[model samples]
Target chain A: MTSMKTPVTLDLSAAKVVTDWTHTANLLCCRVDPTGKYVVAGAIDYTVQRWEIATGKKTVLVGHQNWVRTLGFSPDGKTLYSGAYDGRLLAWEIGLETPKPVKDIPAHQGWLRGLAVSSDGQRVATCGNDKLVKVWSAADGKLIRELPGHAHVPYCLHFVPGSHELVVGDTFGNIHHWKADDAKPSRSFEVKEIFYHIGDLAPFGGIINLAFSPDGRTLTASGLHKASNALAGSRRPVAVSFDWKTGEKRPKHESMKKEIDGTMWRAVIHPTGTLIGVFEKQVGFWNAGVPDVAHLAATPSDIYDCDLHPNQLDLYTAHYDGHLRAMRIGRG
Target chain B: MQEQHYRPCGDIEHLLGRRQFMGDLLAGAGLLAGSSLLASPVGAAEVAKRGKSVVVVYLNGGISQFESWDPKSSLETGGPFKALPTTVPGIHISELLPHTAKQMHRMALVRSLNTKQDDHGLANNLVRSGRMTQSATEYPELGAVVAKGLERADFPLPGHIATMPAGVGGRGNNAAYLGPRYASVTVGAEKGGVANAKLPDGMTVTADQRRHDWRRFANSRFRDKVDSVEIDAYTQTYEQALRLIERRELFDITREPTKVQDAYGKSELGKQFLLARRLVEQEVPFVEIQPGGWDFHHNNFEFHLHYVSDFDKPFALFLEELAQRGHLDRTLVVVMTEFGRTPRINTGYGRDHYSRAWSIALAGCGIKHGAVIGKTDAKGIDVTDRQVDHRHLFHTYLQAIGINSSSEFDIAGRKFPIADPAVGPIKELLA
Candidate 1:
């Protein structure tokens, strides 16, 4: 129930495991409201839960028949959209006291792995294991257009702020960029830094998380660097940056030492220029100005996804152990 | 000399005419010496007289019981898939098997299997051979045992066949102790027909006959020089190869209509199952089809979703075809795995191998409809009632096919029990 309000300079070396909210089951994706007043998460148990930051009050929204893996909030933060493994998209009117889905669309043939609401909140985009990107009208759940060039399963998607462009990444290291009103890919590139497990003949790691730099000049794709074996979780967290205009690749950032290891599931770049990424068992922070990364937090179980507070000093993590954790990132 | 009973497909109708032509080509030069290749009875009554056959769907690596037959959807390790209700009242399985749920009435589910061996190789050997490791002797695998016990010498097709490469799961030489005659004929899963059964290009039918005569002539000369068991084995293999060549038309499953192939779903595993059904319908005695890659030590739910979805539809359709064709009463269908995955979620977000309690299913032949043989605890962690092991499963399969489980197999001057005498079949699973 503790509120993260304190403002201090960034010092991740002093960070610690702080808050644990334990009402949800094995969470997979999470997001912080635009105002940072609430945290919403999708859990494997087929429900989406929201937690009020100041009061720690929890509300569970249950309609999905299978694992709800990806979620997004409307620009105004008044509505929430969730995509589930059962191939359904549900839009919940979150401003209501007892929020229930206003519309439920059978969205895909396979599990929906990623969902994104447009900056104007007029349309929603979703990608799934069915290997198609679908856009829907936010108001009526009407299908807009289907984009189908991704040859592999897309894991995540993000809308570039203040622009109508969308970036989608797949199980392989391929990333596709599409503009509004376009059925074909506008641009595409391979982030070779994202490693795949060749021995298993399976996708080792793909783009797990992607975010645009505050100025939109750099695109950061965070995932495992080199997975000796994906099933064994023998992977190292890495974040690779690409210059948006030039498509020039930058040096990848390693979150841990060679002796230590974890898979990075989610990452976000704070407006203050701190690169925050959550690994399997640890969270890391690297100042865009400094070369070294610092440990921001540690957990007893794997963290599946994370979102930084809009205030830029606190973070929320959805865990594989069924806990929604929040950690203050400045001055301990 | 026998009445035609049933033709496997439309293409099989032309088999007898082709057989006559091939038989005439090889008849003159002692190549057919007392052996009537492709001249066996095609009578359905003769197939019935050969007793029942079995199709073993071996899943290779252990499949998770929770994700398939006995899901514990309420536990932490229950995973994301919910238990879907089946046609049989009160019976439920994972939603991953939606199609299979409709066919539950024909299935006998044994949810409590306590085979103590968890190592992949050992468990695989135990399940396939129905015995513990022996230092001095090797027991025949399930297919080999069935082949030896039920083989029709006059039939051209091999008694035991596997739609997989040889040597997987220690099965390369599964005919251990039974010698080579009852060995499984390996066929590629996706490759519809037997490999190398067709004559080399540019070799006319007459030239192929001449080559066979020349080989036999050389073999006879070599036999005169040395009397060895290896030579006898090689001679038998040569004869079998010649027989298959005469009846190679039966192996050309592509001759089946495209509609039939589509019914089988177009997956490699689906095609294998379709071929297995055809073999069993021909009364092959035993066919083993392995749809491998169930070793999900990570991302268990994700992989199981793909695996089960790929498996469920075609399997259900195959079972329906068997029932409609009347083969369900004389052919046994078995779905088995080496072990089951753990109920504990590992750090890598997957389940590890667990052997204390698992599941295997039986249907058709003498199996009882709508039967559930054993039970697992709520968390699917242990056997709560009627725990069965590999020995019990072996016995159940034998009994289902009307074979005597107590029979002895005399091999290498020793008598070995077909099934472990210490355990017996689950009587409730029997019709």
Candidate 2:
């Protein structure tokens, strides 16, 4: 419902917007640092770009041979981990001038689907085509434990806070809860769908670009529409909320039919729990409590990634069309 | 047993003689004999001395426990199927497996196996490998270990043969960490049968013999000219390939009697299981027959009835044939799935994946016949006692085939434990 004009330079409206280095490479996945000082984006070129939240300067982290599929920031915000289709997880130190990989762990035999960092920063969990969710020592890149029980590829991984548990959703629509310390699962819940691919999990509400909610009380997951062929319509984005304690799930909120001509690339919860941002053709937002059609701003081309500034409720939207737009959230 | 009902023929004797001749040729060639084929020395002696083999009928998707092994006859969880009594007084199986129940004198049923994985991929990996997924290294499959421990190194065909699609049930069946050379030979749907594995098209015996002679001469010259380890490895693989070609008849099921073929069912899964029997009889240590499409999340009764009937006929026939041929005591037949379907039927009239408790059946070598181990609650919701996870299953499998499950493999300089450190074999299941 909103229309915006292209700008040569970054613009801040009634809402304070921050300037950031726009990326030329299409972004596949993005994560905000725990402290909100940096934003790490995995690009289609298999390189991870780390941007300083305050200055918008970028440092590229390179190692993956295939497109980086997912990214995670350690709890300490000192280390950045990226999962790629090349079946490797690369750990990058953010403090370095040019972000470089410190450890490269070949974690899966197939494409690395998801990556997550524990609350303590000591463990990192990853899952992929191997159907096993493995936890690694962030300190040494050594394998700590493996959580098994997924029949299909584990599409997303999330570490619930305050508990030693990790939640994994697979392509088969099954969600498993694995105890982080042990190599076994504590419980599992099945969503009765054919090919449900869980795209992302945001627990609690940090900005949409951040790791799971620091509290681990709530879980928000995005589902792909193409998982089941019996559905009459095309793939669309659906958001689900769950209580981390009781394992109770709320009715899913279905957004607008995913842009078939354009892919609904990424979805993140805004720092405020009420607002969730979905990036496809343009930047769109849906309120978690309200069951309404998501509204998107018109843009020149498909959007790849977007992030909210830590200090202000501003949005930084990046497009595959090689443009970055900084826009206000509240008003014109 | 009725004398005229079924009788052992002289075919087994002829096969034994052929096996003896091959063993003599192997010895003459100075190839390592029997258990010495194992890379590890820990169980080499015991494995070499033991002549046990395993035929695993892998039900790829989760098979419903209520419909198969732990049928709650009078309960709602029992679905529409009825449980029938077997020849063994107290033992019973689903009516679909009436043939198997008649032959229950040689089988042991584990009614309660509470494995953690309900997801197909994870459950398959865990159940097959008998270990949890570790981030540091890939775990070796139980079949791979069996092949490593018990198979002859110089044997022409691979010790482990899988006659199904890879990635059928998940990560469980792959020969992980065993390397590609030791990985199971996957025979396709049509060609996996014993008959189709013969010499290539348009090749006469005389021409084949001439080719073999030339290959031997060339190999001898190369061995004398180049003493490189890589060349030796290549030569060894080539020799193995030739040997497998020579024994191609072992894969042909048409060589079997018409009654035998009819007994195992005419379905793909049935034929595959028959092929597995032939492979083991030919001394291949481990053979995995994967039959998929058992997920049955909806239309539980109809789907299971169709699939289970297809499985039951062939499975029972395989067991009966093994017993009649006097190979049952030396061959282990295991029936397993990724996990069991849920006890409660959902709105779709299908059961979901349930990991809490399930069933697995073992017959033949080292297993206690007519024994039902473990138990589930009345509704089949949870394991009432004797919980067995993948670790236990792996341990039991190795123990049945005369290998120690506590063995470890060194991967990436770390001594990774092979099975779950917490669980061991169900001793009661072993004779």
Candidate 3:
């Protein structure tokens, strides 16, 4: 592993593969532990797996009864929380020698799409098909309060780092802001670019992923766009950013390189102010301040989720090909 | 007889004179061409007793059985949804169809379907026609067959009609050897009512009436001079067209009461179901509507959530509306797809096409309500008990409407056994 103790340049174009490990099933959602020593992912086969960063040893944590869609980690890195399509939320002690379930409960009425733990580790915000955003106790998995304002099913939620404030995105492309500490609804805005319908019918793939920039100034929503024929899976990957403080949408951000057919399933902000969007066929990284053309790298399989290791150099991706991939940024 | 079948406003009555008129028309046409329609029985006595009608809802691109009728959610192959109990005890379907689940008491499910053919075109033909493809012969689809077997020969409107998306509609050639008389006319799901159904704006009502009177007189004079089959068929078509023009408003669902339209909702499938109701009210024997885009080879679960949500409510409402209107006892409503999806989830989080095991739903008419027959194995890869194929369903459909499947179709002196004569109806499914 390269040391970041000395100053090093970050170059996405020259990113190199660091570690790649296999899972028995396709991984849907993934997260890097707070300690940055382990990466955890939830799989299609109903298991939460944690891999040791150095040994590459995989530990399967089974508890979820359905396809897990989102994962959150406690600030101490001792506990891992997974939200699944079956609406069940389970917390596991990932730090234990044999990590076991710490808490489990039915969190929503339907498929739970996103889960986010506050940086303080006191509050957890989640959203699902029930068209609700809920804040819960991270300790016992009890309901704190239901923050309801979304007109459509919400797919992703994220906490503005360092604070309990939250942002949630829905199928209609509406984003809601909530003061998580008080569990009250604030302002909301809809990005029509991520939502579309023909007549009374709408196809899937909305604002599926949400992430906050390190400085909490920019919030980016990621999903497929320009669905010419949603029925036939006619869609392209895209990312849309907004000024977090003013709630104003920025110019459309999309892959300007080789044309691709699927969606930008997940977007994460790099510590260096770069916005990284992972698509089904490619991963794109661009400086958020640059405003335009992104550096894209073709992936071997459909990438569903990705997380940046605390080391700020290793980016882990969960893929549909039943593999967990790691790549080092600025290899050149 | 018309009074027995609930018409509209609860004051409906069958026009016996129209029945006699249609019979006379059939006999007159038989004299011109010696057509098989007359030799073949026109209407079933039982169907005529209540004015039987059929509505078929085709789910384009097969839906996965695991996600609907025959869920194995406990098993690894069950995907991510839970199996929800319906109105009927011991009968549970996928939670994705919560709306349809409430209407389960009025419906029967056939879970163990082994249609075998996975190709869209072939499977569609096999299920709708109830016959395996034989190179030398093509059969009329269900709508056409139902139109031929159950029609009272009374409707000025086409007995067999398929409601489609606004532009992709016209005359369908699925009637096969049954001839154009039994073929279906295509209409819009939401927008255009019927193409060319209106009189020219320049022509007043009086002018159109005069033209109609002149055409009838000219047609009678021509018939007296030349008793040609082509002329008779043409005259029959022209007259029906005139009648259809008079009732053109029926095809426009926007004209339906606001409450009624709201009940059916605004989705294309919803409006089509509403249109099916309007046609059924006018005694159109066979009405079909296709809610397409079911082929979920990729993103199956995500799309199914969208597809099922769109389908669930309107269908349940259709059943409720039919029951309230006293049509449930006579209208045979069916929801079917070509096949079921694979139990194995693919790399794309989708279920591929699998014909070994699937499902279809039937309700109303002679179908046994709340009856669930057959079962698939735990993995949902194959039928484990009482497996029924499309042929059995065809026979059952005919039997439900009081048509004897063993009867032969006298298609211009060539004998064609109705419903593939080899397999019989699922007696358990018949009330």
Q: List TM-scores of chain B, every candidate.
A: 0.85, 0.80, 0.86
- Local error of candidate 3 at residue B86 (angstroms): 2.6
Compared with the true structure, all predictions reach lDDT values of: 0.77, 0.65, 0.79
Question: For candidate 1, lDDT tens digit of each residue in B1-431?
Answer: 33223213333223344544243322222222221122112223333347578998888788899999999966366877789999999999988898889999888799989989889898898998888765356677899777767767677777887876222211146666566666676665444355545544455666556545655666777787897665676576557757765765565556668999888876777777777777777788888887766788876776676678888998998888899999888888999898999998776678899999899877788889889878998889999999888888889888787777776765444567878888888888898
What is candidate 2's TM-score against the reference?
0.49
Best by TM-score: 3
For each candidate in turn, give its C-alpha RMSD to the true structure in angstroms: 8.5, 22.7, 7.4
Question: Residue B220, candidate 2: how far off, in angstroms?
Answer: 8.4
Which candidate should be chosen as best, given DockQ against the real structure?
Answer: 3
Say which docking band candidate 3 falls in. Answer: acceptable
Error of 2 at B426 (Å): 1.0
Per-residue alpha-carbon lDDT of model 3 for B1-431, expressed as tens digits?
A: 12222113211112224433232223232322223243255434535534788899999889888888988954457888889999999999989899899999999999989988999999988999999976568788888788878756555677788888673334566777676567677777666466655544454566556545655666777677896655765676557656665777888888888998998887788888888888878768888888866888777887788778788999998898889999888899999899999998775677888999999999898999999889988889889999989999999998898888878777657788878878899999999
lDDT of 2 by residue, B1-431 (tens): 22222223323333334434233222232222121121333345555535578888888778888888888743346554667898889776776677778878888999888777777788877888887765455666777777766766446677777776321111123555544334565553345343223444454566545555555666666677776544553456446645665776676677779887777766778778778778767777888887756776744664565577677777887887778888887888899788998877553346889989899888998888898988998878889888777788888888887777777655434465667668788999988
Task: Compose the digit string of candidate 3's lDDT tens values, residues A228-278.
Answer: 766556678888888988887887777655666777888888867778888
Error of 2 at A221 (Å): 42
Candidate 3 — which pairs collide? B2-B14
Better of 1 and 3 by lDDT: 3
